[model samples]
Target: MGKITTHVLDTMAGKPAAGVRVRLFRGAELLNETVTNSDGRCDSPLIENPSAGCYEIVFSIGEFYHIHGTESPFLGEVPIRFSVEVGQHYHVPLLCTPWSYSTYRGS
Candidate 1:
């Protein structure tokens, strides 16, 4: 079975983006919701047995900045949509700042 996992990095701060809210969705249906820990990673995989299909992971970066006192962050939610295959692992990590963000497939 395949699995989905994620983490956040605060590029501006040069550290992990802890306390960020993350949401997982398979198509239009929400699958899981979690928050990043001190290491900027979730406690466990978002989906332990994700089937082959389209999926999305929404990162609440605006809220994270707001809590960290960024007044009005330029970037709001960051949503990453991707495709996965059965029996393959997907590591979708976010490298972000209050103004911009990026993501890619990782091991």
Candidate 2:
């Protein structure tokens, strides 16, 4: 079985983005919602046994910065859409700042 996991790094702060809200969706249907831990990772996989299909993970960029004292963040929300394959682990990590962000497939 395949699994989906994620973590967030604050580029500006040079640390993990703890307490950030994360939401997972299959198309328009929400599958799960979670918050990042102190290490900027989820406690468990977002999808322990995922099927092959399109999916999305929405990160609360604006809210995270606001709590960290950014009065007006440039990026409000960051939503990443990707395709999953059966029996493959998908590690979609977010490296972000208030102004920009990036993601890629990881081990």
Candidate 3:
């Protein structure tokens, strides 16, 4: 079965970005809302039995930075949009900091 997963890493701190909020959306409809665990991974799969379509995941960056003690974070909501195909597992990993972020498709 196809699935979608994600994790956030704090590049500046060199650790998993725990407590960050993540939201998944299919088009304009919200799918799920989850927070990162101590490992920076959602407690459950964001999308299970996934189908092919366009989807986006929004990361709550500003709040995370604020709680982590960044007075002024450069980014707020970070959204990553991509398409899913049949029979594939999509692992979208984010490496971020108060100033910058990056993502990539992982196995």
TM values, all candidates: 0.98, 0.98, 0.98
TM-score of 1: 0.98
**Candidate 2: tens digits of C-alpha lDDT, residues 1-107:** 78999999999999999999999999889999999999999999999889989999999999999999999999998999999999999999999999999999999
**lDDT pick, better of 2 and 3:** 2
Ranking, lDDT, top scorer first: 2, 1, 3
C-alpha-based local distance difference test score of model 2: 0.97
- Expressed as tens digits, the lDDT of each residue in 7-92 for candidate 3 is 99999999999999999999999999999999999988898877899999999998999998999999999999999997789999
**Which consecutive 10 residues in model 3 have the weakest lDDT in total?**
43-52
Residue 70, model 1: Cα distance from true site in angstroms = 0.7
Which tens-of-lDDT digit does each residue in 10-87 have in candidate 1?
999999999999999988899999999999999999999788899999999999999999999999999999999999
Per-model lDDT: 0.96, 0.97, 0.95
Top candidate on lDDT is: 2
Report, for all candidates in order, the number of backbone clashes: 0, 0, 0
Off by over 4 Å in 3: none
Higher-scoring candidate on TM-score, 2 or 3: 2
- The alpha-carbon deviation from the true structure for residue 53 of candidate 3, after best TM-score superposition, in angstroms, is 0.9
